[model samples]
Target: MQDKINRWLLDNALAHHPDQQALLNDNEAIQAASACQGNDAEKLAVFADHLKVSSQLIAVIDDYRRCFDMARIVFWLVAFLVGASSAFALLTATANHVNLMSVTLFCALLPMFSLCLWLGVSLLRFGQSDSISGGMLGRLVNAATHLLSKLMIAANTAPSVHQNAVFRAGRQWVNPWQLSLLTHSSWLFFSLGALLGTLFRLSFYQYDFYWGSTLLDSQQIAVFVQISFALPAALAGIPLNADLIASAQLDQSSIQTDRAVWAQLLLMSIVVYGIVPRLAFIALSQVKLRQSLKNLPDNYAYPLFRQALKRIKSLSEQSQQPMLAPRYPLPADRAAHTGANTIASIGIELDQSDRWPLIKEDTVKDLGHLINSQQYQSALTALESLEKPVDVLAFCSYARSPDNTTLKRLRNIQDIAEGRVLIVLCEQAIAESHQVDIHSRLIDWQTRAHEHALALVDFDCSHKVNVNDVLNAAEREQQT
Candidate 1:
């Protein structure tokens, strides 16, 4: 399950790249994988394997898991040590009798109170379990993990790959329920350590136990003690009666009472109250965590997966039909036209097999394909160098899905053009049979562009690039 989740995270991170297949140099592998029949995950697995950075990404995830597991072990060990020391301090042989009330407060009452508080918080905020850490202990662990992550990043320990994927995966691994499980396990260890410490101390030395309260009488104390000891006594078969309680009262009698009963009661209280409840909560956390992980959502609508599915469907259609030449040539220079809108044209992630519907070389300056950050930066530099703002034509293939990166790229172009940019969707590269798919993709892009108030137009390669559509769209915006 962890491996599957790691793979999903890696895919999502990689999909954010401007052109992952081209940037990773896995175009051939991706093409082959698209032609094969498989689920999205299997295809993504193939895509992951073909990438140059996948190995380093996997190594980073593995390293994070190791560090996380080690941190948990250390926390449990520290908790056990603290519990042992606390028990030893409380039970030390002293001149005054060890207060049975104090022992009960530390070993049973306090722990029970804390447990109930955690349960209440969890139940109240059950709908937002992921947003909430379990309690103070859960927050402490998260804070520690966050601090460690920052240190690693500052030191550049894991270089040349996306560090967020590593840390994000770590965060998901230690989600709220996972933290709860760890907390419960740590408490269980603490209880066991305290029990062991008590047993060792009792074996080495003898201590008297007595209870006292200014507001309560011997009868009242006896009744409270009997109620408290009911479960422990029933479980362990330890004899508890009003006479034994009356003898141990500090004000009623100073006569040394049965020390064995008090010791046995203390140990049984730790086991019945502290250890048992922690174990039950740990099991519950485990079950809930499993259910959450198993139902983890996969966004099939994500642009990368959408593109892969489209390719599979497109290729399957092509295999069934006879091949024919496209109606229009790949590259055809547009006839000379004079307009302010014809300042420049740039192709974005154009298909290798098809060509851009070109403008005359001297009429419009051409910025090459915006496939990676370097190319995008170069295009931005060229646009910024212009003496005056002009209507720039940004062309992209209609065959591909328009993701957030694509929108961002268009937005940057629009900024440089000072609201005069026109997006041209190249449709000559697509087949006649895919008209429905092409229209669907076009509507998706149009909706996004309209929402962001960007001018966009679509044209086949057979026709000259349309600059009139931008003017018309702008007029529509003004009228509205």
Candidate 2:
């Protein structure tokens, strides 16, 4: 879907004609091009071909996407650095002990505690999942992208709106939660670093391993060990014997101990408890991230697609017709020397208060009667009853795309009216957000009129009419 939207964007960018470009942005155009045609995959392909969007544009967009992914990866690595550094600071070597309990408590169990807290929070029904970048990491990534965009814009001598738009799109598609897939990866790296640091110290110095508590005895400590490392310790073939527990007691008078066995237990506990499960969770997050990236947000639906769709559907229907359009009887000459006043302005189902013809000059005349598409047959009957030939100024709302029924109704007006017919496309003052590519509605009417040979194409409602253009055409008709 993103590809289709971007392709349509490229087609609009490459089009030299402003109207065609605007049409490409039209929601009607997009729907016609992509939807109401074929199955999902086929629809996008046909839409792409219809627009003739350059493959180069897709490649450029893909390249930018790859760069964004790289930025996210870098964010993960930086976050891992923070975690690794924190692990080192908290688990630094303590006073010499017969037991390495201090290192295990800080490096191994501490991370497990943090991981449990994180998991518990994540499982709650929050409105949205928080990204790893929800904190300082987010700020850093935003700052980085901002700098990159500024640098690219500043480096270019000539401003290309397409290029700027593409850059802006890159910023738009960057999903922060998508990068949280690396959360477990960062924790894994931190745990591995802590383990490596412990090993490095153990190689240089021998520290005995034992357990001691003010309330707990050796028998209780042995029971706890068996429960905690039950499956993994058993799978690793480490025997959980009474002698091993007694040897591991800190207050015991007997100093005899199998140091190798005790070290293996602590090391295996970190691998089983800290690293492996985290790696699995990271994989799950990656799967979820991929799915999230594939889905576009609802607001992405184009607003102008209805008009473009109407144009495409109309064109298709016209092609299937035996005659492109029904022929009308040869009409009489247009009302001689007709001005805006002589021309009766008719609003098609427009509101009584609609400020249409927006400007009512003394040169123009208006009946101010709003006729709907369904009431067109009646309007035609009334036109036929007019005393003399007078031009009919027809109004069309730009807010709605011109449809087939509209074309048929216009034909009805032309067939009955003796004078020239003109279509005045009406629209409210467009907002800045909608200013881009909004001329498609006007062009759609013009194209439809040209196709069926019904009415004159006047300027869109937003603009002041060049009355001289109308007068000149009328004068030519009078001369003929």
Candidate 3:
């Protein structure tokens, strides 16, 4: 969890945000830290006392956790679904051999060989990051992250530009080692399944296993066997004699040999080559992941943390009192006038079910994704066609944190609309919801919305609204 937090703070966009910028100064962080005067636990309490540090840190951690949880779920699902299928298919093919009386060592070991080849290629390509980005595994991971973001969203619509960028950027930084752990875990399940399948059949069925191969000398086959099984066979007190090699031919009844040696070699080969190495890689990846977390630089060096401290100090000093709550900007009253132009009720991360306020015969637009070209174009076209100074009422989900993404998106709307735009936050209607305190989450939204001088409102559960208030606010903005 701590490692994920470290990774989240590394996102480049955070540096571009005002909140993050304010948190970037070393001097400010040091000044904020001066309040701490005890052990680690007490120090953490002191750090929490500073407003910017806690909020920025929580947001980063939350962002990373959203994707991490999704990736991990996809990884385990692959382990069982892909692993079981591969093992079952190969094991069935092996068991269905018509000439079970003369099973060649190479034929029995084909599954392991293919598995090794796949791991080799994946590792090689893992080094070239872009090469794998569009590959099967990468696509699976991307889909998982996408789905994760969707499931976590309070609204069913696609996320904002900054939100999409955040997850897309995360894909590039998730280390190959972490992905390798997922691959190795799947391999372990696959190899064990195949080995167990073979063992199960062998225990119940009677069959003589001998070595055979076409286009290769029996002596050469024997030599290959010696190289592969020499150590395991030796450990098990088994020998590959020259006479045994000459006698071991393709299904010749007179050249029959004990099948026990072949079974030992096959089982040992599966254990030593397939299962052992994968387990080792999984362990190694774990160590590397933890080390990466520990190696993350201190928060004071981070721009986001620095900006957080800065925000806190500024708020305290400006008010001429200690900071109490997040400073918010209340909407200012504007000169009232009768309506003239269209009212565009754009939904920001909102689903279809959420109601938007109806303005007297005004244009209404529904956009699922703020950054996507199609949705953006549709909304822009509507605004362009409408008379100047359109009133854009944006309905957003109250469940999600009004992070930098929401701020940038709404600000962008303000840029293009050339009129009044109000953000209406809808309540969480779905049950079995998140445990985060509603008011606490609202604080984040209020702070961000206030930062941009945007109009904001929370949806009443009844979806009831004063028609006059809605119309008045729509008509209040000073025309550009």
Encode model 2's per-residue lDDT on 76-104: one tens digit a residue: 56655654564445334343354545555
For candidate 1, write residues 137-221 as lDDT tens digits.
6567666666665655555555534667566555655678877887788888888878888788878878888877778787888
Clashing pairs in 3: 22-307, 23-306, 23-307, 23-308, 24-306, 24-307, 52-308
**Residue 449 lDDT in candidate 1:** 66
Q: Which candidate's lDDT is highest?
A: 1
What lDDT score is found at residue 5 in candidate 2? Answer: 49
In candidate 2, stretches whose alpha carbon ends up further than 4 angstroms from where it belongs are: 1-64, 75-99, 126-180, 195-207, 210-232, 241-257, 290-295, 298-300, 315-480
Model 3 per-residue lDDT tens digits across residues 402-432 = 7676677677776676765677666555310
Q: Worst lDDT window (10 residues) for model 3?
A: 98-107
What is the TM-score ranking, best to worst? 1, 3, 2
Off by over 4 Å in 3: 2-162, 243-247, 255-257, 296-304, 314-480
Model 3 CA lDDT for position 162: 39
Candidates sorted by lDDT, descending order? 1, 2, 3
What are the Cα lDDT values of the candidates?
Answer: 0.66, 0.54, 0.53
Query: Candidate 1 — which residues are off by over 4 angstroms?
Result: 15-25, 35-37, 93-96, 126-133, 153-161, 213-220, 252-255, 299-301, 312-480
Q: Tell me the TM-score of each prediction against the true structure.
A: 0.61, 0.47, 0.49
